[model samples]
Target: MLIRLAIRDVVLIEALDLDFSAGLGALTGETGAGKSILLDSLGLALGARADSGLVRHGADRAVVTASFDVSEDSVVTGLLADNGLEGEPGEPLIVRRIVKADGGSRASINDQPVSAALLRELGTRLVEIHGQHDDRGLLNARGHRALLDAFGRFDTGPIATTHARWRAAEAALEAARADIETAERDREWLDHAVAELRQLAPEAGEEETLAADRAAMQKGARLAEDLGHVTTHLDGSDGALAGLRQAARRLDRIAHEHEALATALAALDRAVIEASEAEDALAEAGRAMAFEPERLDAIETRLFDLRGIARKHRVQPDQLAALAEELEARLSRIEAGGAGLAALERAVAAARTDYEREAAALSDARAGAALRLDKAVAGELAPLKLDAARFRTAIERLPEAQWGADGRDRVEFLISTNPGAPFAPLVKIASGGELSRFILALKVALAEAAGARTMIFDEIDRGVGGAVASAIGDRLARLSTKAQLLVVTHSPQVAARADRQLLIAKSHDGTVTRTGVRLLDEGERREEIARMLSGAEVTDEARAQAGKLLAA
Candidate 1:
């Protein structure tokens, strides 16, 4: 609940601090006593736009601070914790906004600098101000669905989960169908590429091996004449082996004639043997070096074909094998997708069925809640001078195209002000007085779950008096039982019913007229009420009536 409000140099107020208590409080004063300015100051603290004109003529800045006492687990405190602005335990949460004369503003919570956006978010949790032009709370139909759901105790989680699953299934099916379509368009090209690659059948490292062999064979062909000469030198007629054999025979014939000739004959025998072995090795090498043109032709042809195919596919010859493998994988996916399509279609249908089942249940729950709500608000109408008017919670099922995760229903408050009158949106069909009374009735119905700590009404009793005004007071007083309520009204009956009353008055100090609020004593309250009852005069009769009204 709001605990304190301090305003400095804002409009007609200068250095004002007002302490607020729980339950119903009333603000009453003559017209132009600056009641609106006080509300505006509170609004400024709640993150409303800053205007330099609101600052006092001689002041550099206008500051407004609103303090709220909230439970540790309350939404306001939760918001503070979420924003890292939590203050010391057992301390009140304070929001201070300073508006400079240049139209620039700064906001803080518990003395920690915060953005205006965060301040506005905190305001929504702390207070709800209702007036003729106000757009927050129940006035905006966007909030009606959640309100109805909250009232019904219907959990929307299951529907949301099913909706998400359905959407995922839809997205997956869309992507799969697109892939299959694209693959089908390229089916012919894939088949032709696969057949050609299969026939070529390129292998890894085959290009380098073939090129090396071809180069070596070409070099050997160039050296064929030289290699043949080496062979002839060892084994041809009159070659080294033939000469060595003759020498060895001569030496062996002279070995029995002398010992010296025997040693020389042994060395000659070894030399002849070595020469014959060399001749045999040379003959073997000659056969190996003999070039085969057909072998070279075959190697050159294979290398050329592989290189040409690689160029056609814009890949290295060694990469041809990998390219073929990738094409085969893609082709296999196309076939697999053809079979997966049927299964995915079934999945999409199942997901949609789950979503619809849950959504239909939620929609039915909303219908039941709306019926109860309409009855509740209708019961409040007679006491509020709106017995002839009908209040309704209109639930319309939206078209499939407009359906959302929230549900398929559009919930709005509708009204009919007269017999045979067509029902229209509440805001459009109701008069200002009727709207305020209708809002009061709705608030009374929803107070248990309103979630706001403070609710303020500006001129809720406007254009109303007598028993109707008293009934409005009764409702406001009752509303205060569930949450803090502050009503700014001209109705003396409303003022008389307040647990606390503050009078707004303009005091002239010759140089300036300043607006201020002061708590009124019983006698002072009577005089104020008397003034309201009798207009410009505070007659004895009015005072008697004021006393009677206060007593009642």
Candidate 2:
């Protein structure tokens, strides 16, 4: 509920701070007394488009701030939370807007800067301004479906979930079909590539192993002739082993002749044994290093093939094995494509069926709701002096292109002012006064389902008086029991029906004209209502009538 509205330098309202209480509050004064200015200021705070003309002369800018006390579960609270603008849980929600003289505006919620569009969206949830010219709230045909659902207390979650599932299934099917078509286009290439990779059979480490062997073979070939010469010197009959053994035998024969000779003979025998072992080691090394010329050529050919295949596939030689597997999988998918596509098609169809079933059921439920709503609104029409008028909750089946999560129906409130006339849109069929009354009846019928916490009616009691004005007053009072109501009016019956009355009046100081609002006391309210009942003055009879209305 709106608790306060603070406006500064807005037109004639140089500075105004008005405290609002619960229940029906009436703003009453003579014509041109600035009631519209007050509502315009509130609208500015609620994110209405800024106008440079609204700024007071010589003022740089105009500012309006609306403070509302919102419940934790209120839509306004949820909107604030969604925007990352948090405040103390029970504190008032402050929406402030400043309109510069240049027509640019800035908006903030709970002191956090936000876009004007966001503020407007939250405004729709926080307060609904209903008048003959209102294009938001109940009169916006776009929101009619939601209003009807709210009225019927319908839970659309199931249909919404089903719709999502159906769409997802359809998307999945589309993606799969697209993928299969692309894969089919590459079918021949995939088959050839898989065959080639399988034939090459490149192993992860095979390239490294082959390269290492090729290097070793090339090095051994460079050393082959030198190694052969060395082996000949170490192991042939005329080489070092033979020569050492011959010397040892000669020394053994003269060993007993002298001690020196004997020591020399022992050394010669040890040299012969060491030379024999060296020759054996050389023979073994030659055999180990040997590589056939044909073997080297074969290894080089294999390495070249592996590298060429890797380049062709845009992969390292090590990835060739994995690439082959991937190609095979694609081939397998192509071979089994029909079954997979069929299964997806079945899923899409089933999901669509589920969604359509739920949507149809919801449409039926809405038709029933529309009937009940029309009956309820019919009950309120006559009391507001609209007995000759007819109200209807028109539900039209929308085309498939317009079908959505909310279901496949377009809902709107239509009215006919005369018994034989065709029903037309509420706004188009009624005059300004009739339109306001129609909105009021619709609002009263919607009751707690009307969405906004606060509702402002601009001159709803216009062009009506006597019991008609009293009945309108009683209904406004009745509507206020469920939500805060602020009505701008000239009817004394309506003003007298308010739990609180504010008097808006303009005064001139010769050089400047200013508008101000004052909360009325009991005597003040009586006199204001008297002035409303009479013309230009408050007569004794009018005061008495005002007193009786208040007492009633």
Candidate 3:
């Protein structure tokens, strides 16, 4: 429930701090008594859009702050936690909004800065403002389904779970269809590529190995002619090694005839040995240089084919093997397309059946809920002076193809204000006075189910009089049994119903005008109620009526 409201420099309200209480409280004053200004300030603190003109004439900015005391598990607390604001269980949440004269605004919750949009989102969960022109409470189409469920005390868990199942099935079906379409589109290319790769029989690292062998063979071929010429010269019949051996044999035959000749024969034998070693080395070189052109040609051909295949596939040679394997798998799936598609279709059909069954159940539940809600709201209308008004929970079927997260039903609150009057939307058919009463009836019906600790009614008595005003006040007081209510009103009867009474008055000083609110005592409340009933005069009869009202 809203615990406090503080306002500064907002239009006629220069500075004001008002503490609120649980149960039905009323704010009453004459016209132009700054009652509207007070509510407007509360609205600002609740994240309503700010206007530069709202700032006081001499002030640079305007500020509004509201404090709410909510339970630990309240939706407002969850919202604050979601936005990283601070709040403890059963603690008061302070939401402050500041609007500068330059058309800029700031918002915060529990002293932590937050965006105005976030603050507004949190505010909606905490407080609902119902007025003549206010389409928020039960009149909003967005909340009609929720209101219906609440009124009927229907459990929505099953419906939500069913909706989730339906969406999941839909998502899976879509994904499968996309996959099938893409595979079908690429079927021809995949088949051809797979066949080509199978024919090529590419292997990882084959290109590098083959290229290295081809290069070695080509180098050998380039040096083959030079090696052959050197071999011929080294092994010819009159080559140095053969000639040296012949000379060594002749020197050995004459070595005993002369010592010097024997020494020369020894040196010639060493030279022949060195020449023979040289000849052996040349023969080994000749064998190594004998290049096999056929082997070289084979290596070149393999290398060219590998490189060509890599280029055709737009991949490096090393990636060709992996790419081919992937293509083969894709082609295999395409070849078995009939079987694959049939299996997917069966899965999709089964999922759809499950989803449809759940959705149908949810639809039935909602229909039942709507019936009960219609009766409940109708029962609440007579006392609120809406005897001729009709309340409806209208549900229409959405196309199965257009089903969404909320399922296939569009729910709206439809109403007919008079007999034989065609039922139109509640917001369109109900007059300002009628809308306020309708909202009150619905709130009284669903207050317990909504679990809202507080319900604030801003001038809900607008355009009402006499018994109708008393009826409104009586219902408000009754509503306080379940939850707190704060009403800003001009009706003396409405003021008379409060467990507490507050008066908002504007007073001007020599330099500035200020707005302030005071909680009235029993005597003061009587005078205030008299002021509301008799306008400028406080008559004895009005006070007598006020006394009777208080006694009642």
Q: Report per-prediction Cα RMSD to one decimal.
A: 7.8, 4.5, 6.5
Q: What lDDT score belongs to each candidate, Candidate 1 first?
A: 0.88, 0.89, 0.80
Per-residue accuracy of model 3 over 149-188 as CA lDDT, tens digit each: 6666666666566657656655765675676679889888
lDDT of 2: 0.89
Global fold similarity of model 1 (TM-score):
0.74
The weakest ten consecutive residues by lDDT in model 3 span: 282-291
User: Candidate 3 — what's its lDDT?
Assistant: 0.80
Model 2 root mean square deviation, Cα atoms: 4.5
Model 1, 282-349: lDDT tens digits are: 66665654567999899999999999989998999999889999988878879898688888899999
Tell me which of candidates 1 and 2 scores higher on TM-score: 2
User: Between which residue pairs do clashes occur in model 3?
Assistant: none
- What is the Å distance of residue 178 in model 1 from its true position? 2.3
The lDDT ranking, best first, is 2, 1, 3
- lDDT string, candidate 2, 394-414, tens digits: 888889777778888899888
